[model samples]
Target chain A: MTKRIQQFLNEQKPATPCVVIDLDVIKNNYGSMRTHLPLAQVFYAVKANPAPEVVNLLVNEGSSFDVASVPEVDLCLSQGANPDNISFGNTIKKEPHIAYAYSKGIRLFAFDSEEELLKISRAAPGSKVYCRILVENEGAQWPLSRKFGCEVEMAEDLLCQARELGLVPYGVSFHVGSQQTDLSQWDVAMTRVASLFMTLQERGIELTAINLGGGFPAHYIEHVEEMPAYADAVMRAIVGHFGNRLPKLMIEPGRSMVGDSGVLQAEVVLVSRKSNDDCKRWVYLDAGKFNGLAETLDEAITYRVTTSRDGEETEPVILAGPTCDSVDVIYEKKEYSLPLGLKAGDLVQFHSTGAYTTSYASVNFNGFEPIKAYCI
Target chain B: MTKRIQQFLNEQKPATPCVVIDLDVIKNNYGSMRTHLPLAQVFYAVKANPAPEVVNLLVNEGSSFDVASVPEVDLCLSQGANPDNISFGNTIKKEPHIAYAYSKGIRLFAFDSEEELLKISRAAPGSKVYCRILVENEGAQWPLSRKFGCEVEMAEDLLCQARELGLVPYGVSFHVGSQQTDLSQWDVAMTRVASLFMTLQERGIELTAINLGGGFPAHYIEHVEEMPAYADAVMRAIVGHFGNRLPKLMIEPGRSMVGDSGVLQAEVVLVSRKSNDDCKRWVYLDAGKFNGLAETLDEAITYRVTTSRDGEETEPVILAGPTCDSVDVIYEKKEYSLPLGLKAGDLVQFHSTGAYTTSYASVNFNGFEPIKAYCI
Candidate 1:
């Protein structure tokens, strides 16, 4: 074990499952992003892991917050974040929630439709709202283009509707996609967003913020390294297109900001060979895909299984959760191995699990807290 | 809405996001499974939806239960399932869980390793254990070959180990992957399982039960009609192999028995657009991926999205959850036209959600119950 990890394990209270967030790592991540884009207002997308400690750390690191729901807004408010510093960046739906968010004095909201603009106007009159454009991340498998955001043709109509509804149109927002590996895609998206800005200005609407929505990859995975290149390209495009005319440049980064800072530590509940198949042996842990990480099975992100004990090595094994369902698996590869022969009670830490690993995928299918998260 | 669905919805209090289980639908599903596999013991895998009401319904319908973890065992027991009937199918992990399970008199265990046999010997002593085999369904995209089950060679060793430990090695078990659409694949798996049963007999192990582990599909979408053919092929294969000597056949059917019984009814919270594009519109619901049928996002389980007001036409829309993360989407390309335009406060029902949708996915992502489940 690394001296630091050993100390961390010693400090823990033997919970079979829990999320440990290293505040030091978080601060370092914050500094890294800050160093790369000094001009962009960094808003930590709190939905990734909105634990109070994580939020507090991001706030302490001088980053604002981007919240999509009322509970998230409440979480930030409870943590003493000024409402002015928050952006309810999702398209507002519930008129009541819009009023509630506005009542809490939240100003920066993201809207994508004329209907949503009309509803928000009815709920929170004259609210400052950002128009989200649906930028196509061409070639991405799971693109958000089909679900949310305005296509280029409809973007002007929604912006005009917001203006008509007395919702002060701030700037524009666009998300390329989550875990975006292609850095140059942002350049194409930026050009589209810039054109929208020009078109909106021609329609007599002055914007205040241009939110490049969060999709920055930040994990120990191989793909996370591509984030620096993506971030650089995004920032350069923002500067190149908008330049002095840029609204308050906002970047809501969820995975990139905190995904690496959190480690999901679970105990190897049972390690048993199912058969003498040429495939990998099975190792069941206390955690599963229900914890919002089906990707372990989807093979989206790889998990590096490590033990807290020093001099341990990995052996190839398949990983499953304690759930009775056959689909309850975390890792599917048989060729992978851990250094330590992970037995039932040994702790296995999955690195770079800070983001959607817990908050987004938790289902108490087996009736257990997904994982109790603690910030270091 | 059907009369059954109307009654169920009428009983629910307006919670932001919750699961509603129609008791009538559950009974119907149970009956359907019973009618088809009249002789086979139906062990309702509690890992699907462990709600006591759901389990109780199965018990009343004359179905036994299968549990993996201790809590699941306790959940079934608390619901009045016979302790002897509840199979603790997962390999024992913690000594305490095993000890407790044995004290509760759980005899049917799925054993996969040498350590598990040793634990069972020390804990239950006289427990009847089933040797789990890793049957490969070559057609399954994410096969279980690497996760659980022993290889044929290891099974012989493990069964020998069980006999040495004085454990009652009763039978063998294998599961085709979940949401299995291909019925022909089960033929290959069963052939291998039947071969293993004979192989074990050759090694002087008299096997009793040959459990074809559950991967029964439930129609959440139009393609769900494929389930019946798959079931027929499997049952015919099982009967063909053993020919009335199929030693008390047991199938751990979780989703098929109750998947259509449960519905994820969520309130549409926000409807907005994707930024930097034109035509993309997002319908944000109060429920996020944390609970509102993440199987739709994770496994691409296509669910039928409809309104409580029956006969209403649907609209093409992107459904999102309330979680702040961009990845917290429910439907990506699932085109469904709603009866009316989805506003903030209307209820959206996801059909065929009785299985892995609710029980397995609820995490306290935002310190909220992803879904509140109630059986009608």
Candidate 2:
């Protein structure tokens, strides 16, 4: 946790199961990316954390936006963001929503299929569009499937189809996955993306931009390479294929931009063993899969945790949320060691939960309100 | 879909991604449960669908409530439910919440561990408490882990401690699991519960009740036995051991009571294949894992889906929600056949979604509001 957030928690003593974001950390994360990956324009993925404070900071920093919906478009615009700086990033959108964004002066969009392309053609006519190519997400912690992108051949057809429908086929895009660790995966995606750019160029449809979608790593339980390592790998991969004259470049960073900027605090409601001989004690926390900590589903994103009683003797324990649903478990098979003295009312903080936590919380599930947030 | 909901959908076209609940279906479902399981008092599990309309209807029908949180307790009381009829049924609860429920005149509470029991004794002294025993959830579609219950021996010690701490050691409780299909699982839990009661009786701690926690199934894509069959099995198991000297038996029914009473309608935003030769088409709906359909996380609870065009030639489709998140895909591995002519703007209704769908929705995960609910 950042010093600002720690100080805020200490001074404010907000209720349990709330997240605190340090704007300084967000600014620093953005600055570090700018210092390293100088070739690409950064589009702060708004869906990561749509808090007005975060968006306002990014807007002041001259960061463009990657929005998923009309409400997100309005969020950025209402925060004094330049309409030209926003890109409608989600491939799935209602036709009316597309028209609304177009009316609000959004000129760039993302599409993976013909139906979406057709919608963009009619709704946001003449807008610059990028076709997401389906690439291998083998090494990402939160790997994506065939849900958001299409095959290289289909992407080729779709981008070409965009031009015929009075739209600009401006770029090609692909995401390795969220929380991507393997630098080589970028090389893999860039290879196919570069190949597609060439094929489209030969057909007299020259694409000028490559939207490098978000796959940057966040600080979690597992160690990942530093930002410079990612920047160097990405630069080298791009130069390896498209040597001298590069296309206009853009990067969409979601989790990496704000993930490490906040800490989520929850109180232990109860801790007990199922049986006398049970090996693991189940530690029930006031916050869980519903309110926050959704990335803990399947233990995919393991966040570093610290307790108020840290440094005490610890033992492996099962972690659960305060819900009647059986699937409300946070971590069970994955061994989460806790202080043996931990009991009801002990406080615990989950690190690097700033991205998907508050944004993914359920709306009053089991009569529990969504986790509250405080931006410092 | 019920005739009432169908007519309501036909007449009043509320926006897509809204659930229409037929109060008639809820009343009938409760009546059926009452007719079949005459020996057990009904406790409507409020976590399933805690709509004020649903709670008010059940209250008028003389149904007790199984509440998981303080907000739920307040919701029931605010809707004119008798405080005596509400059970604070969640094993995990905050001390302040317990006190609040107690101050509101709630007398019944659930506990599974010594720490929880201690909290209850300190907060809600003299409240009637039931100890939950860890039981096998075999043959359940959504099997629970060792999250909410303690071993039989642990339960015995806790109950004895409750009596010493000036709390009423009223009963023992166990859930087979949610969406449980196997009838024999009830017998398995009943045997353990009976053995615990006998052991407690020998120790001079006379427990006067046995709470059969919710394990009842909701009608989904899978065919389940009628409510009478479940009532018969539960009755047989309880009688085989208790031999007519039955305690004040209570059965908590969450999904089964309201699961079949509602239908959720969503519009097809787009439908396209990932590749030209790809056999399965990808169908994107306005609603997704975040807004609704959280139960389809692992395709565990498959709701019966019907499109506006149902009788045309059918093809297997990969269903997904309208969000940027990759995990938002509903049923990719599970083959859901849809009409070949299904396209954007066509309406689709998910049947048996009344219970868990609306209650589990996320709080605007991707700029989409929580699914609207209409109780007709």
The recovered share of true contacts, given per candidate in order, is 0.59, 0.85
Model 2's A-chain: what TM-score?
0.99
* CAPRI grade, predicted model 2: high
Interface C-alpha RMSD per candidate, 1 decimal: 3.6, 0.9
Candidate topping lDDT: 2
Off-target runs (Cα >4 Å) in candidate 2 are none
Report how far residue B184 has shifted in candidate 2, in Å. 1.1
- The digit string of per-residue lDDT tens for model 2 on A1-376 reads 8888989999999999999998898899999999999889999999899999999999999999999998899999999999999999999988999999999999999999999999999999999999998999988999997898899999998989999999999999999999999999989999999999999998889998999999998899999998999999999999999998899889999899999988999999999888888888899999999999888999999999999999999999888999998788999887889999998888999998889989899999999999999999
The residue-by-residue lDDT of candidate 1 on A1-376, one tens digit each, is: 2345446768755576776777777787788777877768888888777888888777667778888668888888888788888887767456777789899998777777777787788877887887777677753323454455667667777777888877787778888877776677788898988888888789887777778887677554454445567667877888889786667778888777777777777887777655444444567778777654554655656756577553776657777777655566766643457644667677778877777676645556665556666677
How far residue B271's Cα lies from its native spot in candidate 2, in Å, is 0.6
Candidate 2 clashing pairs, residues 3+ apart or interchain:
none
Candidate 1, lDDT over the whole model: 0.72
- Best TM-score among the predictions, by candidate number: 2
* lDDT at A246, model 2: 94
